[model samples]
Target chain A: MSDPIEFYYDLSSPYGYIGAHLIEDVAARHEREVLWKPFMLGAVFKEEGTQPLVFYPKKGAYARHDMARTARLHGLPLNFPEKFPQLTVNAARIILWAGHQDQAERKRLSLAFYHGIFGEGHDISDKAVIRNICETHGIDWAEAEAAMADPAIKDQLKEETQAALDRGVFGAPYFIVGDEPFWGVDHLPQLEKWLESGGW
Target chain B: MSDPIEFYYDLSSPYGYIGAHLIEDVAARHEREVLWKPFMLGAVFKEEGTQPLVFYPKKGAYARHDMARTARLHGLPLNFPEKFPQLTVNAARIILWAGHQDQAERKRLSLAFYHGIFGEGHDISDKAVIRNICETHGIDWAEAEAAMADPAIKDQLKEETQAALDRGVFGAPYFIVGDEPFWGVDHLPQLEKWLESGGW
Candidate 1:
């Protein structure tokens, strides 16, 4: 069997939301396992010597059009979150905890967070909103919150984010098939094609 | 009938090439007309207070993947140019002159230039090569060369590029449907959708 494809993502990115849904279908087609790694985009930007908006000042406009176009392309309801660039530290921690329990649950929580943000325009930064998302997915919100507060989990998220940066990951929805890293949700199809062709 | 969509492009841009092809098909689908405007990307970047490369270092790596992925998506041979950032002054001038005679020929030459640089890795800056391309398309090479050398045509190209800068066009492949400026080739689909919905 081929090695599982590693997908690194951040909860704050709308493209990550698109990847969350689309990658599943692509992976299923290739019969590839997916390793979901949720990390901090802020830390990645800081380490890369850049700011998010500085790279593209017209990002706000582009992002809006991208969401609409992506929605039309994928038949999904994609709206901007009320408070964008939401604090996803707690969300990342919870995802890490869920990954320890069940990979499927982790995937579920990832999509729920995305839907909550881009679908309903919810304040993902709000702890209460995250708790509600957890509850909707049959996740234990109390335990999830407790795990988020754990210093070890906080350190782990930070360490993992640093690891992503060290791996030359500049953006979310980055897919690493071997040593080659394909960044952005747009590259998902190419990753699948590579996997299907059995090419390194 | 609605006003034609004004397309601002630079001959040296790979994305502009992709956009040129995609927008033509999109216009055909929506029964819309496109007015092609060839401009200088270097001058536009200077006025925007940024260089395209400086805006995103990751873009270098991402651009390669983007080309490959877009090729796979569109099923086109998108060979990246060897000598990028070509002296597009002559190319832009020829395009402007061609636009006066035959708009379709101007569009065809623009695509041919894109293919020459991006698909065949040719040095489009070479006058001989440019002449070869012109002659291949049934254009009088001497007349075309003379038109390119005309001071009035050269000034007209410069004026058009400057006009684009004044109108907030800071990037290549900018599309203006009425007063709204849609920058970047990726936004072509949205521009098409907008035009289909009766010009936003």
Candidate 2:
């Protein structure tokens, strides 16, 4: 057994959601566990002095179209959220809190959150929405709500984001296997090859 | 035959260089011809208020690594240019002129320029280097040199770039099949699937 594949993602990133759907399967194939680290991509973007990929001029429109097309090609359902790129800091806090309790079950909550926000076009930034997802996933809403504001959980996310920056993670769906880093969902195939061949 | 697949690229893009190696084979698989359109990506970058993928801080370093890794994964040779993102305006203009003379042979020249810059780490912005590649390919260097400076040939490059912008081409190695547009070397698979299924 080797170190778990580090999977970094942002809830607001559609590509992140798309990658989330498949990364586990790829990791499972190699008899490896995956550590899902959800961070605030907004903070990374602010630090990098760049915006979301879908906010550029001509590139934005093309990106939106490409997102839908990519989702379709992969047989995943995606509907663009009306309130896109919603503030996901609290959502990060929730995931961090859950993972602290049960590392194995946290992925289900993350998937539920991603599916709600991207797969169903729900607003993840809303607390009610987050609570609904948490409770639906068997997480106690009262405890999870309290944990969302827990200073330790908040610091966990902040420190995680800082560590991600230190690791040169500028985008969502960024993966780190061993010392090698792979960015974007598009690099999934290469990531699999690295796992199989142990780097080329 | 349907309309030829539009293949737009910049001389300095490594991904564009990698894409050039495989697009012809993919297009040929579908019995389609490729129209190689060379344009100044720097001009498009200025318009979009963005720079090359490898110009950003953290993203830049990762992109360089990814480019090398991706090329090796595809079994193609790649060595980073000494002077990257070189003044490729003249290289683009030369291609436009050569393509005007012979559309098919222009791709051969484009590959030659890409091989010199990325495959062998040569400085491609120099007129001597361009002339060497031109002469090696049996192209009339003197006429090509004169054509590079000709105002009409220059305008042809400008018009081609403007047309690319109008078509929403914001990056290198962009492809269009029918009314559908696909971006990046990663999307080549999806592009091929589109070609196979007509549409999905």
Candidate 3:
């Protein structure tokens, strides 16, 4: 069997939310599991010597329009959280922690986080929001909260971010299929085609 | 008649080359004309405070791969020029000059320039290469050379670039259908849908 599609994303990325919404179905069609790996996009940006899409005024405004338009195109709900590009360290930590326990639950927790941020404009960076999402997902809030404070989990995110950089993941919604890297949610069509044809 | 689909691009942009190749057909399917406008992407980059895709180490490598992969996906030939992101001022000037004469010829000359740069890896920044392309396209080489040197034409390119900035064009392969702006060749699907549905 082919390896699972390694999906790398950040909690603060709108495209990442859209990707999380769509990747599973795409994976299912090709009979592949998705490994949801969340890392700090801020770390990637700092290393790449770039800023978030909102840093550039023109690109930022276009990105906001594009984000909503893209979400509409994909039939997904998107509402910008009051604090955009919020600190996602803890959110990422919880996801990594969830993955340590169960991969499926990790995907679930990640999607719930995405829906909260983009679908409902909830600040997932808040621990209360995180705690509430944990409750909704049947994940133990106490363990999840503890994991967020765990040094090992914190280090794990840093390691995963470094690993992502080593693998040339410089953007959110980045996917690795058998060592082939595809970036951006827009490339999902090409990603699917690659899976269907194996390589073209 | 419906307004022409305003296509803003740069000769140095690979995605712009691909968009130039595919946009005419997409326009024809929906019965629209194309207005090919070449501007200085370097100017846009400066104002936006962003570097070209190749400036970042990791994204640069991924872009090289993605450009080739995207070209293949579109079934278009792509060979990187000896000097990529080359000074495209003169190339843009010649295109703008051609537009002053005939829009069709302008598009033809623009495609010829794009094919010369990306298809055959020619250094388009060279005036000799420019002269050769002009001659092959049945354009008067002497007149084309004069246009490239004309201060008015040089200023026209600047004005066009500034106008692009005013219109929120921060990247190549940017399209404006009516007042709606779409960036990137990948967004052509959405652009077409917009043209088909007016707005969605």
Candidate 4:
């Protein structure tokens, strides 16, 4: 079997919410596995010396419009939580935990986190909201919360972020196939094409 | 006739080079007119409190890769100069001058500037290079130079830059179709769909 596509994203990213839904289906068509990896986009930002999209001057306004418009064009739901671009360190810990469970559970938890922030506009950072997601999805809330605090997992996420930096990932919804990297949700079509063909 | 699709670009932008070619063709297919407008991206950058794509650490590297990848995928040639993200003020001046002429002439100059920078990797900020392009294209060099330096023309470019800010244009290859704005060359697909369907 071919190597699984490395799919990296921050759960708080609106584009990542969309890509979380996209990469799996694209992979499925080509009979490929996706290794879903969640990391802190903020950490990536700090390394890259950049700010969040909505914090910029002109790009900020355009990002808000593009976010909704792109969502509408794709027929995706977006409520855009009031605490947008919320500090997603806590949410990412749970997603990393879920990734260890299994592929199906990983996708479920990832999508639930996305939907919480973008689809339903819920504060995903809140432990209660995360707990609700865990309860509804049949995950062990106690273990999940406990795992979040595990120094090992916290260190793992930090290490994962460093690995992402090493691999040149600076944005959410970043995909890696072999040494090639694709960033943003917009490149999914190109990604699918790359998969369909050996490469152009 | 419907309003011309306001095509905004910075001549220094590789994506803008691609967009310069793409927007016109897309507009022609939709039977729409394209208003080729050149503005100072530096001015926009100042207002946006941002830097160019190639200056953002990891994003800088990713951007260099993506720029080439995207160009190749779309079958556009890129002869990126050692000096990219060039001071495009001179090239933009020529473009604005051409825009004041017939549409064909505007496109000719725009593509010439794009080809000179991204296609040929010539240092377009230099007067000699601009002179070469003008000579090859039968443009009046002395007058074009005069236009570039004209205080009124310089003010006009400034006004256009401010106008773009007013319209919420934040980046190169920004498109305004009706009241809706689309930023980035990747959003071209959505822009074409919008033209085809009237709206989403």
Candidate 5:
């Protein structure tokens, strides 16, 4: 393998959840590794003068419906919280903390957080929710909690967001396979073809 | 067969060029007819407080590159005009007039308009360009020019746009199969699956 497919997403992004659910499976088929990098989609939006796709006018309604339909099609459990488009900074900090431990551990905790928030309608942003989920999985609750306050970890997220924006990632579920960049879950098929053909 | 797939597009949209090229081919596979409906995507943008997707900062750069990539993927010629995102009301009026003829003629004319503006980089907004293209195909040059000034044709364009917006279309190359609406060239796969499974 040349390098892991870099996958960037935001926890608040519904499309990010779909991309997360599918990217790993697609990568597995090609015997390729995928690096799930959680970034601040909100930060990107601020710079892009855009809002979430689900917050647009007529398209907004369709986006919500599409998310539900996509979740069903993928056979993934998606119970959207009543308070959606939730703040995901805390979730990112935790994922960054996990990334410091081991790649597998990071992947494990990241997906769990995604499932808990988007899959089960749990707000992983809450410290209690994070602690409970982390404790159940034998993650160091204190370490994870303190990780968010660490300047280095905070800088990690800032750097990641800046890096993603530099790469033309204005939206979530952005993927960079080598020099080629693909954005949104919609680009997955093209990404697959690129992988299969070794760049089309 | 059920109703023909309502294929909505805007003449000035690059993605619309891709949709015009492929929708017919895709629909033919399932023995389905396509209603090529051209609407003013500009009007939709005004209502949504958004500009063309290419005008946005980071996403703009990606869109221009993607349009070229998408054209290549479809094996279609795409020569972007010097004055891009051209004012397409004249072209739309001509299309609306062609729509009054047989569906085949309408498809031919619409694709021609798409090819002229997008493929050949001709300014179809100019009457000379529209007249030259339509006259070669046995359409009366004077009649087509007069058609643009026709209140009914103008009304037809407006009605089509309003109808599309009413159906929750927010972008170019939007599709409505039965009651289901799919947006973007990216949703073509999902649209195909929906047609195959008769709605998943």
Candidate 6:
């Protein structure tokens, strides 16, 4: 692989979780390394002036149907998180710390956070739950928690979030390769095709 | 055809222009009546808290590129309008008036306006330009202009726009067959397929 694909995601987003697995498969197939960049979705939304829902009153219903259809189409088991719109600051911080330590560990924890919320309905906002996820991934919970509390790590996450906004990213689960940003998980195949075409 | 497939459009939108041509082709193939609905995009945006460009500075560039790609994929000629984000109040009013007079004439004018703005780089905001478009479509400009200025016609346009927003329409060039709103022009094939399946 010449350059690794940068996968920007947040743990709270269902589509981000979906793309996490799908991107792994695509990256493995193409022998491309995915540089997972977990960032603050709230910050991105604030900077971009994007509402949480596309349609206000009807968004919940539409989202449910859209997610169901997407899950069915992708053959993935998906259910709405009980504690939806949860705070993902710690999750992003841990992923950033994990990335600094080991690439595989970062990818493992990213999926764990996703599964914790989206798959198992666990409230990832709880530090204890996040600690459990860290321990399960064979990462030191104390160190992960310590790193998350570090102001430097929080600043790094903030910087990355601003960078994403500056790069024309309006939504979550943006995949960037060769300075070309693909906004949504739905555009993954197009991203893969772009990758195969020698990084457009 | 049980009921005519409602084709909702705003003249200032490039995608609406592109869709105008494609809808005609689909209607001809499926043997359905295409009801041209000319409604103000600005009014819809105001009611729905939607900005023409999603309230992000960079989105405009991404949208332009994405629209170009979509147009290319559909084999349609498209040029981004110079006075992009042009006012469509008059254009929409004329479309509503033309719809009342003749559906075919409305469709023709819709295409003409789309072509004039996106294809030929003409100033769609000009009253004379709109009058010329009406005349070119075999609509009497004086009567069409008069109808456009009628308060009742303006009220009807607002009603149509409000109805579209109530029906979960957030963007331009929306199509509705029954209760299903096929959002973008790209969904036309799927809409046709749905129609062919006898409304299952």
Ranking the candidates on DockQ from highest down gives 3, 4, 2, 5, 6, 1
- TM, every model: 0.78, 0.97, 0.98, 0.97, 0.97, 0.84
Query: Against the native chain B, what TM-score does each candidate's chain B reach?
Result: 0.92, 0.97, 0.96, 0.96, 0.96, 0.88
Assess the local accuracy of residue B186 in candidate 3 as a C-alpha lDDT between 0 and 100: 84
The digit string of per-residue lDDT tens for model 3 on A32-136 reads 989888888999999999989987899999999999998998889998999988888998898888878678878888888999999999998788998888898
- Distance from true position, residue B140, model 6, in Å? 1.9
lDDT of candidate 5 over B1-200, digit per residue (tens): 87688999888998998988888877988888998788899999998878997789889888888888889888889898888778899888887896685678778888888888889999877878888889777788788889999999999999989998899988888988988888889999898888888886
The TM-score obtained for chain B of candidate 6 when compared with the true chain B = 0.88
Candidate 3 i-RMS: 0.9
Give Cα-based local distance difference scores for all models: 0.78, 0.89, 0.90, 0.85, 0.86, 0.77
Over 4 Å off, model 3: none
Give Cα distance to truth, residue A32, candidate 5, Å.
2.0
**Top-DockQ candidate index:** 3
lDDT by residue (tens digit), candidate 5, A65-149: 8888888888888898777788888878888887775667767887888888888898866888888888878878889888988
Q: What DockQ score does model 6 reach against the true complex?
A: 0.30
Q: Ranking under lDDT, best-scoring first?
A: 3, 2, 5, 4, 1, 6
Name the regions of candidate 4 deviating beyond 4 angstroms: none
List, residue by residue over B40-69, the lDDT tens digit for candidate 4.
998888888888989888888888888898
Top candidate by lDDT: 3
The residue-by-residue lDDT of candidate 2 on A116-179, one tens digit each, is 9988999988999988888788889889889888999999999999999999999989999988
Candidate 6: segments with Cα more than 4 A from true spot: A2-4, A25-32, A58-61, A101-103, A189-200, B1-6, B21-35, B101-105, B185-200
